[model samples]
Target: MKKYTADENRYENMQYRRCGKSGIMLPLISLGLWHNFGDKDNFDNARTILRTAFDNGITHFDLANNYGPPYGSAEKNFEKIFKEDFKHYRDELLISTKAGWDMWPGPYGNFGSRKYLIASLDQSLQRMGLDYVDIFYHHRPDPDTPLEETMGALDQIVRDGKALYIGISQYSAKETSKAAEILREQKTPFLIHQPRYNMMDRWVEEGLLNTLEHEGIGSIVFSPLEQGILTNKYLNGIPEDSRAATEGSYLSESQITTEVVEQVQKLNDIAQSRGQSLAQMAVAWLLKDQRVTSVLVGVSKVSQLEDNIGALENLEFSQNELEEIDRILKKD
Candidate 1:
């Protein structure tokens, strides 16, 4: 492609929020590479998505070691894109990657052992062609490993200069408190948490948000659209190419029940009344709460990314609107 130049006025429209009590200020909407950006996907589109995100002032880009269809491909692909387009603008970006899922074959390649966490980030750094990532997350809670061991590994990574900040993903409210305690004792810069929080998934609201606030840890929530269920893509029915129609996808067809479609339709009405798309409203709903530091949005197209960014236009909700949403969500 031709030479890329980021918009000079990118920061003017996008809203930035303080990440808990940290010096870091994250965009209200962050880009995620959970879907697309793999080896099998379009490379040019992926490059454009990254460019568009930065052009729109989305500084934070979230990725994981196992993000691609074949593990490690996303990082490798990102390395190429970064060199081609963002090499000079590296300081202007906030790049994050996680490791804690089934990455490779063997006992030492997975989980929260110091050996695994340390080795995994080393490999991730190598693949991404970076000395250090802006943030490195543990990806998930390891029930078998001790919390101290996991948090200690994170602390070591920061002290080793592998990652500037440490984060954890999908950890329960209780587990998050324990992890934060350990990191505090270690004096690590435990900056953030990544959780699956959306209108449909309210698990974070139970206590996780409270824990993050109390611990002074920011949260960048994933699956904010509930794997596309919160969007209008399935309002009529599951499209032939939708994630739900594809076998082995995280969102199964059965999960999109009649009740869900009904809920989405009602929710869509509210979105229209608010002059936003369902996807936009879904993101706004999360941003309505100050506890959520940022919303991690994964998109297949550049237009979707722009639409999500449009959520910054109207982040407010009337008291009646909030109760209506609660009532609709509570319906059977």
Candidate 2:
């Protein structure tokens, strides 16, 4: 409850990348409020995490309407933390939030309809107590709704001054090209794409990264740690209190087979050789590619956040290391 002042040398050690061809520059590591910023979590810890992120020059904070367990709690909690610590530094920060997933119960509460997208941003803005978010994203592709309607709503949001720029998440390469075309026709600033990319999951490599590069749209990847599987936490086995141990979590025990543990152990050995934690190595591996504008990282503790930030120390990989990583991942 004391005052907060950001570090004077915050930007000295952190790295920034231009988001696609945009005028905005995002930190190499951005903080995500997907899990630990909810109402059920510790408020003081969450506040400390936010402060730690900002103090370390992490200017971009990503959130979604349905991020919290009860939905909308993350934004509400962020509002309190922002009002206390970050209100004065708003200009120095780039805050983003998304819609397009299941937010509310009714027909208008979900999907890509203009009504849903527009209303969702209003609620998100209200929850976060902000006049406008730096960037707003459609959380996913709504299979039932037309893509034009969804992209059109995003265009409208920018026109209405509700959001500065628009983005999309989890869209395929073809779909991304189409959406980019629609936004381009309208001259809307479709700035970034939020995809799930990591050492474990390479779906974006199929065509999505190339598509983003061709279309001149940036990407900030989520789940770069593969729901914590890419880290050393699972090298031995799933801990009793780990996400894999919890029922109904996104990562389950079944996903962590003996083979997966072997792979993680091999990865951990490689990480130790590089003088980095497994989590740090996993994150640095993603940044090795220039197309990755930023890597979205989520953490429960401030130390974890700092560890992720430490990935900036070594973002390079030799051909041998790259080949070894490919061999490890491609092994049956």
TM-scores of the candidates in the order shown: 0.99, 0.99
Model 1: per-residue Cα lDDT over 89-164, one tens digit each: 9999999999899899999988889989999999999999999999999998899999899999999999999999
Residue 237 miss distance in model 2 (angstroms): 0.8
Local distance difference test values of all predictions, in order: 0.93, 0.94
lDDT of 1 at 284: 97
lDDT of 2 by residue, 82-115 (tens): 9999999999999999998889898999879999
Which 10-residue window in model 2 sums to the lowest lDDT? 323-332
Top candidate when judged by lDDT against the true structure: 2
User: TM-score of predicted model 2?
Assistant: 0.99
Q: Model 1, poorest ten-residue lDDT window?
A: 323-332
